[model samples]
Target: MAGNKSFFETLVMEEGGNVTFGDGSKRNVVGKGTISVPELPSLSNALFVDGLKANLISISHLSDEGYSVLFSKDYCSILKPDGQTLLKGMRSSDNCYCLEASIVSNHVSMDEQIELWHERLGHMNFRDLRTLGKFNCVRGLPKLGKKANGICGPCQQGKQTKSMHKKGKYLTTKEPLELLHMDLMGPMQTESLGGKRYIFVCVDDFSRFTWTYFLREKSETFDKFKMLCNKIKNEMNSNIKSIKRIRSDHGREFENATFETFCNGLGISHEFSAPRTPQQNGVVERKNMVLQEMARVMLLNNNVPRNLWAKAINTACYIGNRVFLRPSTRNTSYELWKGKRPNVSYFHTFGSKCYILNDRDQLGKFDAKSDEGIFIGYALNSRAYRVFNLKTLSVMESSNVVFDDTRLKSNDHEEEVIFSDVSPLEEVVVSPNVGTSNVNNDDTQPIDRVPLLDSKEPAPWVRKLHDKEDIIGEVNESVKTRRQLANLISYTCYTSQIEPKNVEEALNDEFLVLAIQEELNQFERNEVWTLVPRPKTTNVIGTKWIFRNKSDEDGNIVRNKARLVAQRVLSN
Candidate 1:
């Protein structure tokens, strides 16, 4: 009889007496069951004895089951009725025959193993699953036999999406701006920090360079498109090229009369994709999907708030332009569009903890020189990184910043960590007459600003550095200001008119402090709570302060407001 209930495959509980051993020791029998072991016939009527150490088998019981047991000096053997040996056991030091067998659950069938791996891999296709196993592509994966015979419910649901049509094998456009693909993404559930809910995306078919604009509403789509068109025309006129044709889905934003009139006035052709067929304008649609997915992952991985999605998407596009390669070519989107390589020396990990110099605010001798912030994106108008300052609860662009990207904040050590590509002693190159900041500012500068010393008479700084700088090491890129003025106008709402994240931040603002005082006075007047002696066994109900900016119908903040709220504490 087996001692552990886990060894039984089938069990039945019954009122039973104690089982006596040879030493007159007894264990209470709790249940009777069938035990299934690997490479052995199922043992029936095995008693589960509580407080028993080792399992016991009776030779008389085996004989009754048509098996004969013979004990030798050193071993014991069991034989079937036909005289074939069933099992053999070795004699232990205690002179007891011990049988060795493994539990059935410990071994897995080939099909079960394959199915387990399939589920672990997020329900991958069986063909690829077997390929991975066959080639040992993944460690710890055994040789897969075949797909599981049973259908997976999740696979049927998730993989049922219809595939898109095959992409064309040839390049359709020969130059940048020859053909452009445009698409609009949102009305997202969560509005961005700047109250943007939609992303207007544009792509050049040839270079695959993508541009994205955050919009507050659908009506802003046309304005952004017109601005992009005007900017592109001005920039491409010298190359004898302009936006020749554009493709987009038949959304009301793109198919409107005003949009058509604008395109017709510029002698540009506007083509509409078939209804519900995103593949026709797949260039920008795919880019939109990629950008959104990238943004989602970055936000989730870094635990950044969802309201910062626009910053993540914009940074994704900014990086993709310089990093993603053009199909069937060794050139990048930046190179194909600008006729020169793009430099990404200044790129930092998004959502990285940073310190922005507190030059904008007045500081005393012992005051902090910098404010803690999170690196968001790059600035369009200047050589700077966009940071979301924790103290102000606002986003701003600043050239003077220090990034702490590598180490965890919970770590005790405070040694500064810098990017691997730049060296500590590397000199910062400055313009002809401009004074230099540190390496941080120089790296953040646009690549096109590589100083040129062509006058035969070198500048004083140039003479200090071998009379010339290595211009070939730098890339000449033309920056496109998609909505520079519009961004500046929008940025003020987020920076200057800030909404406090907590009571601590609210205390620092004079307006918010007044708002908080007014809220407390209103609460007292309404008799919200009464002072009482604390009960030793009772827990206190905590409180929280919520701060908001009261805005007018014209979308301008008119007043700072604060409210006291009882914190919700959930109990088990």
Candidate 2:
């Protein structure tokens, strides 16, 4: 992080927070953006931390980004992934590595300035940034000098194995929302904390702008699609634009009657790729892979729980829209869709340790003012950060949050303490504790085993009856008549509390519907089964509803219970 605001050319003021230095003094981090220093690699996501006497560099962060930090008696060197020396630092008298270079000056040359913008745009190739500058396609881009050439360590690490997808023969859509590609990916091995197992992704062909929705079941795809339609309608009506066509693979979630009817109602043509061919819907197919890969990397790099996969994916989509450029237009999706350059100065590393103000409850003067949390994503409806609170074990959105992205996660206490914290959300199989850290508390004591008692004789209640007379006094017509009368009265009392036998009958009754919903909720809570497309060769099993009315000892109906049972006859 840079100390001075003048160090950043594109700083945003919205998401400022306090940063604590090693000396225990706190300074305000007012914004974040790219920082350029002559002869040094341009820094992306640099925080504008105010009131520091000297700029600090994190060797740990450079190592994580595929840079090698070498230290010796007199100096230290920062090398790129390919072992090329990028920067050298001298050991100070106080035994700290200080960089030889200084902060960027006001009279820096245009070439260095263009190089800085290159890093700002997610290390985009200079040719594209220059193209945008030349054509005036994107706002806030300055004129470019001759193509700035450099080896970007991050781009090399991220895209080394990736090859560009070949373009289609036909001309792409010319207007926003003219054509949309949508697809569904998942039923992930792990269900998210929100019980979401599927991601519905839609990408506009013209702008490459994408929208993602997390769904508990694939059956919800239609509902999310309808919601996106309403959102797009409101945003596009002023521009005289309407959805012209939408494309997806032949998944039942997309090819169903509900989706067809909705699209037809809006005068939108729905197109389907041929069965077994995913490339035809490659726009969203590729997007699904990219989003998942990015989210997976972020989660794994930060040692975050897999149950927050939905949050990571949501954040990935949010960042991709702002940072990624369309190859055809050399403009970011945000610029093309919203007609303005996106301000990403508020971006933070996903899963960074943060503190959220504990203002929800009254606190004493001596109490800590903030709760430790893990930064997850940005809230869509408000200007707040979404955080997973450690103490409450719940996810919340808060405007008053400070980030400590530079700190390393301590393996000593965090893993053991929070391992149980995630269990209530889902059954996660964590590795057994194997570290050598000594137990510090006297409360931990070894359990003493108790011996079992042996007995051969059976209890009186265990004996079986040999004859009917042993249990009851007698069996006669008078006793049978009494029993019949009791049963008849019970049946008459419950005549108004009938139970449904089938789904059709259950749907007609409000009480039965509520009972069914409760049962479904239980299934979801337990993560019984993920909803998925039916295989062609496998016979589909049918289900039946078994409903019952529970009565108290007074014969008053107490509760309506419903169970969804599979028909075994169909399985045969």
Candidate 3:
């Protein structure tokens, strides 16, 4: 045996040459040589042999060489050789080969297999697809053959409706009092200071300037309009032109003869909106909103009392005129009207606790230097400021004032001590240790030892009553008989129960009836008894008189009370 074998051979080789049998399972060969082997077809070629059995079931080859004979199977064979069957199974169509002579007779290629893979995988562009063989997971995926555009569902849902009024159509006049819009608002539950329950507001259509006046009754609308018309006319020095059109709701106040006549007299055209239509006078109506909002904010910010909201509202309007910009103009109403920048240096904090100099009081060594007050508002007609004095219980005007801006909170003032000019000795003193002292005692009596007179006993006459008896009798005779008799009898019998005949008579009896009369005059001067008659439909109670006597320490009568009482009536 040779050490090397031919390319087409099934020779077994070892380190040395040795001959191996056809069945080499039990033999070992060490040499290589060219062996007699049948030629096999190339993988690229097909083969056809003459005189071969037809309907061959399979073909096989052995070894790594170009060819080696192996068992073949016929269609009707009982069993095929295991080695031959295995070799035939391993020979795939893609890997098979045949010689050039066989290729010239018959040929085949793997074009079908290559096409099958392309069909199953789909021809996706390698660059488009990720390197890992999957679609790229990006934020925005491009549509096939289209440019990428990100989707935003939220943006679509959040789209808003178009504005009603576009740019450039809003009111844009620059001068104050040139164009005015007027509207009346409310039959409010609360009546303002001055007992006003309704508000009539006028807004300058150009500058967005606002002026509000309170009315106790809506009938005052014409008066307010007239006042506004005169003010604007005098201040602007312009005639009541077409710009002086007065816009208002179809209220009785706006429709009444007084309003129409006033408008006609001033040559001002009246523009009345339809009934229940507020938007027709939209300018002033909208201004009312602006004013009310500002008023509310000011009241809340300064912690001002709600009852003083009228002042707060007025102050809000003043500040709004100075600060708020016109919708169409960069300048404010104050700047437009005054033709100069407004000075805000005089603007003090509203509702701040302040001390107003009491100009009404003549300064005394013991008098307070200033009166406690709350800064309410600025005076519109004057340069002074308005303050609500807690001590005086009145609204007062003062230009001279000191304010504590940090103290905007209310109900924090110290309680005031009210003093009277009367001496402390004048006050009635009740002492438990000492028995009630007599109001009347002889001046010559010893201070400690004299016995005080009983209150029930009548003291000695301080003056001669007999001297006046003749004059009293003459005056008593001039009156009607029944009245004179009633007076004389009532006086004599009820002297202890009521007041004496007169102050002089009471004084003659050592009584201070003059002092009591002086106090009574004070109550009358204060109008404590000016009662207006209630309406018939009103469920008013009937009043009655109750008499009482005021007494001193020793129980001596000092004054008398004639009070009225009422009896409740059933409500409807």
Candidate 4:
């Protein structure tokens, strides 16, 4: 269990050794757990005593397993009866059996640990990543310092952009569906689960909830948008209803007369960013950036094939929605969006080892009942998990599976008290940056798609980072126009709250953890996907989270919101 870093024993030894302490106290080892690592596939037993200072191996146990111990003048050797030595032990200068083990002490400073984690997590924003160290999510992670310093190369390479104007502020709203931030990402290096090359992302400004859809072409955006609008309108069903407004880039797919007409017909307002100024729609653009970054790491680190990129992004967005803290609110996105809390107890490390039970396969008397696989993410539509089966080389979801998260699972099942009580739902005012805003600027012309050159594919994010400053990052003075700013005081105040960085921190609060799980159960209830044998020559789409926090009419925090989506990949 991660709760216990080191193991010892006090279970009353059956037939072990006894060493007298200076104070004449003695300890007997009785309880044991398997001690295994990649280097030692099967180290039989480890004790559970809390007070023991040193680790000891039983000589008799080794002998019983067909080994002989030989004593030399200066050293000792454990060997097979035929004289083949397995391990060599040295006599310490203190005349003790210094079991020839190389003990390396690891001491890491908080800053250094932060830097290492920055690399491990693919150089995510330092401010958001600081809590990973604080939560002790990974073993050997030291207590983190409050601040992080130093620039990373990959971040400088992939995310660099000219600084933006400091004056742009947030817009506020009263509830979910009041406003939606929409954006498109496309024309990629690879195809997705459905052969899609584009992704449509929709974010709710009030709850900070986001939803994503994969498309084969830009024309498909409107249809997807309408579908979500209908679903949300029906779900929210109340005296106060419908999407009040939508904010997006000045792309033709959105700003054209037809799109405007559609939105207006539904009592929804349409707004566009200034020409070449995506920061005006920074909320969803940033959402896209986060989704892409997370997908990149999950795929690259896990050795998942590029074809699974869609699954990775989808899964990232799903996880992000449940755990990521929205700066402007005290509650997470899931809590605010849904009145009840979410439960997230089943979340496991992406890319870790897992075993899927082969219940579908009729096993012979000697057949292996489980297939070894890599942990990917949660199943889209079920209470099972999605895994990449090494044998089938396909992704599948199943409930009858086991996880080898030795470093994460706690041995004790007792309730951990992170919070004393669950808080009641509070009103949440959606930020204009996230969802709803009244835009009157109709003068900007629609943007036409520039045909891709046959000789060049889209520039990698690392390359685009340098050229996209005009559209993203810093606001330039040269491009400044006579644009009026609204009363941005509420938006300014919203950015000052203590938002959570990851699920681990949220898990520290027991109420939030249960809330996370309940949120996941919704997907299962919705029948998002099914667990089945991997079909030959077919791609199983991956899934993930996009999280947020909703605020009340007065801009006080509400709850966290999570969205599970597909990492839509491009088909070959």
Candidate 5:
């Protein structure tokens, strides 16, 4: 009995003496099963019989025998119908049976339990399930399986090693201008019409209102900044308690001695962002971007020249202050500063073709009526408009102008003409002797007049003596000695005509000689000479003199041009 009980314990089965068979018949089953038993049913066969007896099924080994047998409740009842029958069967010669009674129970299969476990919990991998199973508390619980979907490649590629971000604490101020952001933007490639290539941007921390100034050079920053500050102070009528702090990048223009001295003298604090870190001065940097973008779009759309970008940016800032709403307040900076709505009716299209009526002109019948100009931008510090004249290639200013936004650009059309015509007048000419005659007729002889000569001699001889005497006197004055007189007489005898000889002699005269020499020297100083040596066999052309007097606009003599001519000789 002890051995049989041990077998029942190992197999997890209940033991009974007799059991009722199927068909309501009973059978006496036997005493305890023997130990070291042979020819017993296999685990599969035992499970088959147990399953037939009860809806709840399990499999186990009854003994070491390979043969399988089936037993049901009818068999157990037939073996032991009553207590006396069971006792009789236990004493029987062939009573070697141990009966097991069928019991009703509910259970689940291993596969169904696994599916149910996965449904209750989420999907998990085999490795994860094995790890969870190692916990003795959760051992024997069903495991979950994972879906085959994998990791994202793009996400892994995009992930980079990054340092932890340090968030800076916000600095608070009590007043509008307490803290300000200042930056200088460029030495732009194109120069503005006013010759400005750089711009200064300043922003108020509290209201986020921005002010910008176009500058020809960075050196103008201090002067323009002082002007801005003075204007603000005057307009607001509020003494700046303190500048408090000024933030900027470490540009040399902003960090120079001049700027430092100015700030120190004013007792204003200055702060510099870390090297190469623009985000530290993000407010002004963002303002620069906004202004630049607005200017770029305006220029591109209007086909305005790139040089006008600075003016466009200034205008952009002006319009932005009036139209752009504050991020926190939902009100324009203009409204906040001026306490009124901005009037946009005064705005005009930039770079549009315009015609300006010349109101200043008191026009004659033949004068041009109007001037054509291209609108460049609005004038600063005034209500007038700025325009560019293609004819003059200069900018002009006017307030009364007619604009045609849809005007077509014409290749033949000229720019505005500045008319400068005056009416012609007649002049009165007087001979040199007329003044003397007039004074004589009034019976008042002037002290400078010479006595009149008498004409009593005959016409021919008298003219001859007068000409001869004049010639003799001129010769006497010109000749310094007898030798020069002899040379002059010899030259006059050799030439064919006395007129030509006399003219040549006059050109060779001292005053004419000096004037020609001076002109040649002047030309040499002006670098108008080119020297070239003549070839031995070639005929060199002779040079000659040409005279011209250069004059000023008022007809006054300024310079004389004595040109030397060279004529090439043609070989026969």
Candidate 6:
């Protein structure tokens, strides 16, 4: 947090009644609200007493916020139900637990001021503010404390429930989709992109990877279930095995004869929770809550319109599958569900300012060649990006995208695009990017073809690769080199951040300049070329400079290299 004063004004005094402190001294309560903290939600119901020297939270309040408070001989913490620490408090000299603050103001401790600003800022999530705070992402944001207590009162108020989820009632499943939790949400204030008013969700008990489907009517759920079942049957590990069991609320969508007959036909058992008891289907029930909250934050942060609710849900599901932890597998839901490590290197911040190549829709020679857009999600069925064109007010998918993922974001191409290989759509990954990020197509291949440097007639050199080639080629000693093959195959190294754009830029850097000079010296020493009178009709060849970087064992840049090479440019 920047520009936040160290001390605050004792500005607004209230006539609240007195309260007793842990030290047995009573003080007049001046003000109270949830305080912002890192990682956790706002600390709820924290009172601002007139004369307390330390920050304090009541143990009972933590319990109300669904956190477990633990005490040791000299340490303590407020933890989530899964035992992850939310806030760590140290035991003071008086044997009282006290949380340390990096920056405090007034006797009031800027928490109240933050609460005021927080509401003024449309009550954006403290976590979002904390992240966006790094680069002055928003205006009037005070420097924030490094840690926050996870107790947002408004957030809790929106989710007040009749009963808490029973943590130990269900055992974790061992196989993917061994049990499925189903739920529906909606009748939202805004309709989705496809005119949907409801969303149907499914959760895998073992992998915890959630799937979301939009529906215009509740009756459509039965049909969605059948579609999901058939999809699972085709994509599942074994074709013979089908869904074993399903758990859902006793809503008519899951209880009616149509749903029952479909499950019975597949030999799947359906488990329905008791009436009005939603915690029994807590898995998908909880997933819906998380998805809605995530969507709210994304739409709010990007200033996107409400009509794109379906896009937000798509992005939310994608993020949840990749980011959330699945306790049963001790890895991400994507890995367990896909059976391959998910590739996340291509991920860019959602809703960041960006531009798409206007190659197909350019107006004229002088018109702009890139259209302004905002990143929304990944493109389906391709290794491409999905974006909302700010000018066109429509969503389109393209791989030729550039992004400025910083507070200084603008339409100008000032900074380099976060990703380099936004080439035209080509086969790069095996699966569509649903909610899961894709691994590079080459990642699944055993080994990459070695880079080439020699010939230039068609291109340098590449091997025609087959699956078993690298597995035994090294030991077989019969693998062909550049001359062994009849027709040469061309392969280039993947696009990267390092490779110089032009020879002029390469020569400006000392390392590259020296590398090029060294190559020239080698050419002279070998007597490769000499100055001579120009010939009138000699159809000359062309030259190009290639640049690359070298690194040592730890993957740090160690050297810059430049290669001066000749190419046979045939004249027509």
Q: How many collisions per candidate?
A: 0, 0, 19, 71, 22, 14
Computed on alpha carbons, the lDDT of every model, listed in order, comes to 0.65, 0.66, 0.46, 0.56, 0.48, 0.59
lDDT of 5 by residue, 1-572 (tens): 22222222123344344444456654332333322111111122221112122221121232132223344433322112122222111112344333332210101132333333322121122233323322211323422222223222221222222564443344355457787899998888865534567889998776667888777678888887787778677867874464667888888777889878888988878899999999989888878877776666555444343545766676667656655554545455566666565443344445555666555659688565556656555555455666654333346666766665542322322233211221221121211111000000101100110111111222111111235555744554653344543343332322212111232553533223333555655676578868888799987666656655455464434343455566445332
Best lDDT goes to which candidate? 2
RMSD to native for every prediction? 28.0, 23.3, 44.0, 24.7, 45.4, 24.7
lDDT of 6 by residue, 279-397 (tens): 77878887887777666655544444455667667777876675454652345577778765554446565566677776576368666667776677776666677776655545787
Better of 1 and 6 by TM-score: 1
Q: Against the correct fold, how does model 2 do in TM-score?
A: 0.50
Which regions in candidate 3 have their CA more than 4 angstroms from the true location? 1-169, 172-178, 238-243, 408-572
After superposing candidate 4, which stretches have Cα over 4 Å from the reference? 1-171, 238-240, 405-572
Candidate 1 lDDT over 503-537, as tens digits, reads 77766664465566567657765788888899998
Root-mean-square deviation of candidate 6: 24.7
lDDT of 2 by residue, 14-74 (tens): 5678888677989888778775544445566777787777777776767766888999999
Q: Which of the numbered candidates is closest to the native, going by highest TM-score? A: 2
TM-score of 3: 0.42
Tens-place lDDT per residue, model 3, 149-251, is 2211211222223554333447645445456788777876644434456778888777676778877678888788777767666766764343556677777
Local accuracy of candidate 4 as per-residue lDDT tens digits, 1-572: 11132321112234445445578997654445643221111235555443566565667766775778888889988776677765678888767675554321111244455555554343456665544333323233333333334565445545556784342244487777777999999877866534567889999888787787877789989998888877676666755566788999888888887797897788788888899998888889888987887777655443344546676676666656655555555444666776643343455545656677776778699777677666666655455666666555456767766765422222222332222222232322211111111112111111111100011111112221234546755545454221211112222222223345665565443224434554665656568677789999897777655456666665655455555566666333
Rank by TM-score, highest first.
2, 1, 4, 6, 3, 5
- TM-score for predicted model 6 compared with the true structure: 0.45
TM-score of model 1 vs. true structure: 0.47
Alpha carbon deviation, residue 533, candidate 1 (Å): 51
